[model samples]
Target: MNQSAGAAQHTHRYSVEEKIIGLFLRTITQVCSAFIRTAAAAALWSSRLQMLSEQSNFSDDENVPGSSWHTFSLQFGVWKDIGPVGPDRNWKGIGISLLVILVVLSFIGLSIVLLSKDTGSKTSGSPLTLDDLFQRSFQIHDPDAKWISAKEIIFQRWDGNVFKMDMNNNKTELLLKNTTFATFKASKFAISPDLNFVLLGYDVKQVHRHSFLASYLIYNLYTREVQELNPPEVSNSALQFASWGVQGQQLIYIFENNIYYKANVQSSSWRLTSSGQDGVVFNGITDWLYEMEVLHHQAAHWWSPDGSRLAYLTINDSLVPTMFLPRFTGSLYPRGTEYRYPKMGQNNPAVGLHVITLDGSSFTEEIKPPDGFHTRELYITMVKWVAQEKLSVRWVNRAQNMSVLSLCDTTAGSCITKHVMVSDKWLDGQNEKPVFSRDSTAFFTIMPLKHSSHGAFNHIAMISNHSSGKDVSLHHLTSGTWDVTHILSYDESTNSVFFLSTEEGPSQQHLYRVSVMDSSDKECLSCSLFRSNCTYYDAALSSDCQHVLLNCRGPGLPQTTLHKLSSMREFQTLDESAELRAALKNRRVPKTERRTVQINSFAFRLELILPMDLDETQKHPLLLVLYVFFFKFSATIPPS
Candidate 1:
């Protein structure tokens, strides 16, 4: 009996210990499974919230109720709301729960790292949309005449009112209102020399680069009267050319391929030339060949300084060939347009220069070409009045290897060759005009720099008009390794010639002043003027060199300023681009980098514009742009 009791007690104790061990393992499995479910629910909720946040457009004053932490807590409460422990907890459930929790937590941490890596750093700039391209902005128009006097400047506002800004206080005064003249919108206008009338061009159609056909209206400033400018013979036809005469309210215009004159508004129009025919001949206005190649101007006419004489070219194109171009405008059959085009070794237009006196008698004379040129084949490249009765003409051979600058006696109707420049290559005299001195006894022009070691560069040379014979005495006025681009103006008071030159750098053009008497007294006017903003400049000086209109282009936004010519101080700002600067305050703008690379003896200029937020370590695609004969390379990277 004693042995049986002992065995029963030991068995009971072992059974109790096994039950405790089982209970401990079950508790652990349940805890782990709960944790895994909670973790999975948390990850799923986070992903949903992230997606919603990305899709939502939140305003500053609005709140997102679904993204609050309280929502997350409520979701976790669903697991806790299920009562105490279940009896089926196992090791397999614990293992799966732990594995799932590890994966979800790892993924969440990786996502957090990736999203936070680029915070506070800039990304590539946004690409331009169609809206950016087609949208219009407020812009200031460049003044018609560069050297407009402060008293004569009149600006047309967007509301169709004319205003004049005061230079003393920067105040604006209304000159004309749109309500006064509602029938016409002036596309271009010019003030008469007397400042009493405005020549307005309306309903304009462009015919070429420098020519237009338009209906003209003359507005009287004092009387507030507007009248159509039409001759009695062709009342409704478009005028070929209309421009202000040198004096009073006088005007000259071209019509029906011929030149016409008006001494004043009340005077009857008089025809100056009667040899004009359609497609065969043109008077006072250039034909296609002359306009394209020789003159590069539509009106081949020039008025004398005193407004007494008019010199013009008469072009005969009857022998030239015609080229037809097709005009397509969504039509069933395309229309053809014909134009006179002179090809290589073909028949060119015959050109002649004629002068007409504006007196009541209407005397006319033809200034014949020099004896050396074939008048029919040669080109009358340039013409200018050097004096009241003397004119300067430049004539070039058809071979383009020789050019002669001649002085024509208008009274005698004869031309005398004053100077001749010959070039083994082609002489580029068509675009250059000789600059005469104040006394008209000497003239300046650009010639190759003698004994230049660096390379061939153009410098200013003076030719004496009082030469003994055909051989004129030439003197070098300026010499350097740099090239003078153009002669801006001559100041007779100071005896100084202002010009543009590439003296500071090859890509830079700055205003320079050099004395005609000294030649060594040189000054750079624009190099240090706008040190940071402008690298290229052009200037228009008043007749007396008292005022200047300076055009600053490049390196930054372009600016136009009115300045005192003597001091080079800014008098007024014409255009400051205030609207454009305000619009670009928050946007990314292109940045330019200019570099010069030297290969052997040649230097190539390169301009590179890279994308914003450029990455140096990554390879990027590039676009290269090259202009023929310019040797300029530019690269632009598109935004990603």
Candidate 2:
């Protein structure tokens, strides 16, 4: 008896659903058919009238009055004679045809309104205007803070004064007054390792992406004294770059393409290289190809952990071809400037790795590239100091499909290949600095691993550094369908590696910590915090890994905060962006939806920024924004 009742209910439900779908389809079909027929009839009569006028020789008469209309009227009369020949009959037929067309058009219009109502129209709020995009109503506040120590951070306030913030007590203190170095109109500043001296960069000028030229001044924090880095007697002595060493107040600057070293803020500068040639050889800095495609940074120098030895690249572009770009403004004749640009199958910059000692006895050692690259052109993509006596360098072939990571002995100037990565497709320059374990026996880097037929996703991979040559083994530290975007820091105390990953979704980035000893012991740090507004995030960990500086960037107004990792509690709110939140509360804003679509055998991440109120039945224009950088490609579609 129960089986019979169940079967009857199922049959009734299926019939009711079928009837509803049938009614919808039939209504659509009837309205469309009627509209098409009426439109076709009107179009036929218009085309016939045009054809008759074109076939008549009287159409060419220029001295005639309404000659084309007269021809059309004569054709109408011919048709009328075949039918019920009379003036009133002709008028009556046209009126009836127009009435039928109007009725069909009205029916089609009414059907669309009904369909929209049935589907539930999403039109409620105002639509975003063009001005809203250009002049964004939603403002994001960034602290632009950098960690100086485990419990301290340094940031510049809006008034240009630098402040020091303590993570423990949530207290802020002014470190440097804006007016102290305001005479030079300083635009950039870097604090020394001891946090005593500040290097002020002024009169800044752009060279290329992530590179600039500026005049620097050294400011004493206690004494409040300032002095120019370059001597006043020297003509046009702006430096290409300046940075403090990892220890004390040791300074290094590039002037006239040569690297110069200063023992301290009061010491005189000593030249390190004299082979710098104009537009030919670049010392301690990257050339066009290296900065644009390879290293993606201007600085080509690396200091050992103890700051005793320095490793730098001497790029010789004398053999490479030069391209002259003409400037047409501000002169009667155009001015041309030459740039070292290597085209396809051309000579790239000859890159040589050199290590120099700075402990009293100054000497230089040239480290040769790895085997199979001595006779072939190779690009230096990464350089890092693994130990006081050892440094790591990554070398890639001309096609960038193969990469070799070698650990070099700074004292002996000899390198042993530790790991090698090869791919059929081009390799993304591994520009990330690998975090070495406490014993320096292993290092963590991001690599791709195939997971469950979703294709390969980026995950954290740890390779044994103690093993030399190409026989090293890579162990997976983190795994999933999502990708690990960057490695933030490694804590030796907890044996945990912190990194940013798209574990939540592709459009969102959150912080995650995984134990190197146990791959399954992983926890998300930022997933539960600020769940409503913050989706994308960037974080920086202090040297001791006790605190984290987090930047919450959009799906809403951006926010910056500091957190104590031990308790997983928010230490402080740096910027709440209350003004921006208030401004957007009453204004219309675009909404973003993250979706993943499968095409063929590949899955692609798609982000759609739709209008506030979207009507499915109405036609809307689409705008596609494509961004291509390095080997990465992303697409954003917005309503137009």
Give the candidate number with the greatest lDDT. Answer: 2
Q: For candidate 1, give the lDDT of residue 25.
A: 50
Residue pairs in clash, model 1 = none
Per-residue alpha-carbon lDDT of candidate 2 for residues 1-640, written as tens digits (9 for 90 to 100): 1122322333222233345655766776687677667766776676565445444544466345533333344463464212211112234446666776677677667666665553332343355566655653443545579887778898865456788998777789988887866676887889898889999898899877778889888888998787888742385478998999989999999877788898888887778888988678889998877887778888999998888888999999988998887767788999977888888898888999999998757799999988789423888888988888888888888887898888888889888877788999887637877777766678888877887867788889988845445456789998889999999888988989999999998788999999988999999998868567788999999989888888888776777888888765655777777756765554566556554666687766666666655443444556544433322335544434
Model 1 agreement with the true structure over 274-298: per-residue lDDT tens digits: 8899777999898867776778789
Off by over 4 Å in 2: 1-141, 167-170, 180-183, 231-236, 326-337, 465-472, 578-603, 608-640
Please give the RMSD of candidate 2 to the true structure. Answer: 19.7
Q: Per-model C-alpha lDDT, please? A: 0.71, 0.76
Pairs that collide, model 2 = none
Clashes of each: 0, 0
